[model samples]
Target: MNVLFNTDKLTRLIANLQTFTGIRTNTFDAAGKDIQLSGGHSDFCRLINASPEGHARCEACDARAVEKCLTARNAYSYRCHAGACETVLPVFESGTPIAYLVFGQLLDDSSVKQQWENAEKELGWYQGDLAELKEAFLRLRRFSPREMAAYAEILEALAQYIQQEGIIRSAEYSDLQKLEMYLDRHYMENLSLKRISADLHMGTTKLCTLSKKLSGGRTLTWLIAQRRVNAAKSLLLKSDEPVSSVAESVGFSDYNYFTKIFKSVTGITPSAYRKTNRS
Candidate 1:
């Protein structure tokens, strides 16, 4: 049984999980768009951003992670091209692959030092580059094989949480499902309950009732916020647009109000989110 994820709830839960484990988590949709857990990139990831070549190498690591996770049908761990250990887990419900959860980007200090020397001597790393990375390299989190295995267990449990939280009776959402899909497609537009009701050819009262039921007690406004905020996240990460422009692009006209709602939804300002998540 496929399910459309509740992005807000799962993002909040993933945030708490990251805090608990001191490990990062990221989720991506089937289309490869990040829907939740978009930030908190590890220092190993940062080091790879030092150059275009290094960034390409980092992409290789990410591709490897994705392939391993999907192929294994469970958690997959490997040493990244940047000398850090990483893991990814495929998220599936009822045999349909919908998303992925990635975790554990950690570097061993000694391994990093050796790789740094090798990079400088063989890979054309600049004179001051490796030195500049010393701090973040030393600070990069490390985990043993056994520990990563344990983290995989924890991630397995959390993956179940996302699946279970998304579980709702399908019979109750026939009309609501169509509405939900429409909202997801057009959430960037100026939408209203009245407009939606008219388009659905249903009475306002009936629309409101069905909306409440579909949202599990949330109003349609909540649905809008969820869609817009997630869209804002993708924009903030994928481009260098200004926060105000990003706000407007996501259907939030008032910059201040957008900042307030963005912080409320993501626990960080738009600027901070971009800074943390940008490649």
Candidate 2:
């Protein structure tokens, strides 16, 4: 992973993955330090601080084993933890393992009996009657192998998304940035995709397509609306500006329209939001 790329981007990507696919997301460095985590799928934080016997031995063992495998792999990949439901997938950009995308947590369910023999050996446990363990494992819902494969495919898609983002950043053209900055400066003064596109020497349609792709569904108008709404939030928070004035400051000509949109996006009227959230 590039040190220049901060955790903010990775965190945001994890959030996106969770939204797009119902799977947990996490990122660990090449040396196995967790950089960002979402979905709260692991108890590593608590486990690391606890005494040996009380801590999460299974999670610790799995993380250590995954790190070892990652260290040895020539390409980005992951090995399924010898457990019933969990599998770790590594996200690679240009053959360098930058992140790990772990999914499939159906380990505790029906898989126990099906994989009982295998998991016991993998965990280095004696094959005594696992009736007690099975009882405990049955508490959580289990997924089948097919379901696990579906989750793996989702993880693979997320990896491709992160990879595409890396490729875009590496290219690092200033056209998109310039267009956004220009909009920020002049959105209140009447801006259009045609004008911004002309300034950037890009066709309007192509610019719109690229902008939508980069923004994850925000069109030019929606982006402008978001900026205006964000400005409205700041004004609502900072000074005691009237709603109408705040709307004007944020490039919203119609106070009613601004209020409607703001309420739609935030689930509360600006006045109510300011009152509740503002200091």
Candidate 3:
């Protein structure tokens, strides 16, 4: 999914928050892919990620937290697998989540000793140096219950600022725009009219009509060809790969057909286009 946002601005905002709070913050797309402003992972987390088993458990823990946050439709805080407290807040647009803001890699002051005992027992399977892990764990910041609640409020307000300022947004697309986005993302795959129709939930005939109307009488097939040719052109200009290799990369299996389509779209052969454009 393509999330529209001012990445630099979002980074600045989150970085400022991290600087002020002494806590790490990160942004993730709806699909759980990191966006930017990772603020750096805590030493505790780095240690967890370094162990293969610990890494897998950490990912599972994060996935569950994201799912819970989506279910609550608000910030959800929980004790991580390794016992640090973390919170996740989903940024919603039109009742749909576009992004997530996650903060908190700290412990609660009231439960530090008990939580550490739990963490040590839980991570007993970890193969790394246990003493170093304990040192990192003990170094985590601690907040009282009241302070944690206040931090949650601060995170909520930050989420609101991100939404109100349009730092992250989900674009509402027209049918044509939807088609274009789908094609752009899937152009490297084996695409057919039937597959497009099924995916878009539009009848094949209606899709054909819409394609013609939006594309000035061009067919969907032509649009796909044009998309592939455009991608090929970028590769041709930017890389020294062979034209045939470029053809395969852009979904054209047959070199002869790729040459024909390239010529038909750009009024020049791929090789010639590359030679002239590069010069």
Predicted structure 3, TM vs. truth: 0.61
Mind giving the per-residue lDDT tens digits that candidate 2 earns over 173-219? 24566667877787676677777777778888878876786578788
Model 1 stretches astray by more than 4 angstroms: 1-5, 31-36, 50-52, 108-128, 167-176, 179-279
Error of 3 at 110 (Å): 1.3
- Against the reference, the lDDT scores of all candidates come to 0.72, 0.62, 0.85
Q: Ten consecutive residues with minimal summed lDDT in candidate 2?
A: 42-51
Identify the leading candidate in terms of lDDT.
3
lDDT of 2: 0.62
TM-score of every candidate: 0.53, 0.42, 0.61
Candidate 3 lDDT over 169-233, as tens digits, reads 76533456688889999987899999999999878897888788657899999988989999999
* Model 1, global lDDT: 0.72
Report lDDT (Cα) of residue 256, candidate 1.
97
Encode model 1's per-residue lDDT on 163-239: one tens digit a residue. 65663222224567778888888898989988988887877887778778767898888888888999999999888
Candidate with more favorable, higher lDDT: 1 or 2: 1
- Please report how far candidate 2 places residue 191 from its true position, in Å: 37
